[model samples]
Target: MNISWQGVFPALTTKFTAEGTLDHAAFKHNLQAQLEAGVDGIILGGSLGEASTLTVVEKEELVERAVNLLEGKVPVVLNIAEGSTREAVRIAEHAAELGASGLMLLPPMRYKADDRETAEYFKTIARSTELPIMIYNNPIDYKIEVTLDMFEELLQFENIQAVKESTRDVSNVTRLRNRFGDRIKILCGVDTLAVEELVMGADGWVAGLVCAFPRETVAIYRLVKAGRLDEARTLFRWFLPLLELDLHPKLVQYIKLAEVHTGLGTEHVRAPRLPLVGAERERVEQIITDALAVRPQLPDYLAL
Candidate 1:
């Protein structure tokens, strides 16, 4: 289950019913859309998927269901966002048992463990399962920076294969590459930074906004990797407004609203997370409307 990790892999949002149950139909629809759009892989139960609130059974079922639907089309990777080292290991083990191809692991959830402790937490989980692990380095939102030094230590473990470089400082991508070279694959985790990171040599994207605009997302990645910078930037300029939604505090709601406009997703979210309203809702709708109105046509070279 070695993932090539070289293209757009949406950090998919978990769909839920109005009453907060898993919406299987919508979930499958979204998954199918990403696969059809030529995403390199699928990552489930990430922050955008509301990982903190989903129970163990729900997470397990997510992996099981995605694995079934993917049917070997692409790799199915699970995100482990637990607080306790023990819990993270348990979840990683469960993901491996459920047939996940890889794991996107965050540091101990909520608690900002020091470097040594953070390394140990990740190391413990890495040992618990045979699945390849992508260390999620999102210091901006997660408050834990998996420093180059920390990664230097963690990479000793063979399965510690990749990094989701979301420090919000694109320089870190270059830093990781300078240090690790190709020993570790670097996946750009920030939606807005996708083009810059890819241009600067990110191996792939763990895209958030891709859940809504899958074709454009994949297009940007493909264009960049194919050395078509001019074409990539053209689409990126058009994509930036929607990409900004993935950076907002309410990104999940914002992206889902974009999805609604594109007919790819719904506005429904789980409890404690409600739909947008009033001026806020109007503002988001305006952005989506303007983008869809002039959505750039894919270059003839891109058959997607």
Candidate 2:
């Protein structure tokens, strides 16, 4: 699949069975929902997809499964968050071999590399693979900001095609555009700020809450691009509470619960991340349930 990098691309959650194994059935079910909702691409094994916990073999299996399942209708992108440049390059090359359409490359994980080191890390991976790369510039969580100077240094590599703009500042979208112009596509990475960023000239969205509410997510993007702000704002206002679930520390568990309510997935997460319980679970559930109770009637957004 050729990536236009101009629409909704879900940062999909990894599904697990009760015994703590990959649940291909649940994963495929959610993938189908994303496709049916007219998403632009499918991104697997990212932060939301729990990339840290997945073994190398398991990551490869996900890439293979998504590649076969989507079958060229859309691109299948694997997220590479390795700590070593060697391993990151290895995964990039392997993902390309397994027919992944692109990669979401994070800065060296677990180490706070300086600007030069970070740029070199990304440049090395870009040189190693033919697959296009989206630099995951999420400094707030990751601690290493891919500043514009770093982007300038890394721009020589053609495969470093985009940035998942998670700086949590809407103005940064304009800054990227001013510096790089269209040389690098920008996808909004924060779910709560997706619409705001989209309106401010983001090329697309790398969405998290989209795991459960695929249609609404896609609709918001389509409406914004179509210049239907009133409708987009109305739908987004209704979606605000649910979208906030993606901002929590336990976003994986929170979103999995949303998926359960939506019948798109189960809440079985891997070890070190348990299912939500008690008042926390009840509070999140109430947010989801209240939004669903008055779920807005979407416009015929596909027509846009």
TM-scores vs. true structure, each candidate? 0.98, 0.99
lDDT by residue (tens digit), candidate 1, 1-304:
7887778889998888877889899999988888888899999999899887799999999999999998988999999898888888888887878989999999888788999999999999988989999999988898888999988999999999999999988888889899999999999999888988998889999999999988889998988888888999999999999899998889989988888888877888876888999999999999989988998889743553
**CA RMSD of all predictions:** 1.2, 0.7
Candidate 1: stretches off by over 4 Å = 300-304
- In candidate 1, position 62 carries an lDDT of 91
**lDDT tens digits, residue span 1-304, model 2:** 5577889999999999999899999989999999999999989999889888999999999889988998899999999998999999999999888999999999999999999899999999998988888999998999999999999988889888899999998999999999989999999999999889999899999999899999999999999999999989999999999998888889999999999999999999887999989999999999999999998888888889
Q: How accurate locally is residue 261 in candidate 1, as Cα lDDT from 0 to 100?
A: 84
Minimum summed lDDT over a 10-residue window in model 2 is located at: 1-10
What local lDDT score does residue 47 receive in model 2, on the 0 to 100 scale?
87
Q: Give the CA lDDT, 0 to 100, for residue 219 in model 1.
A: 90
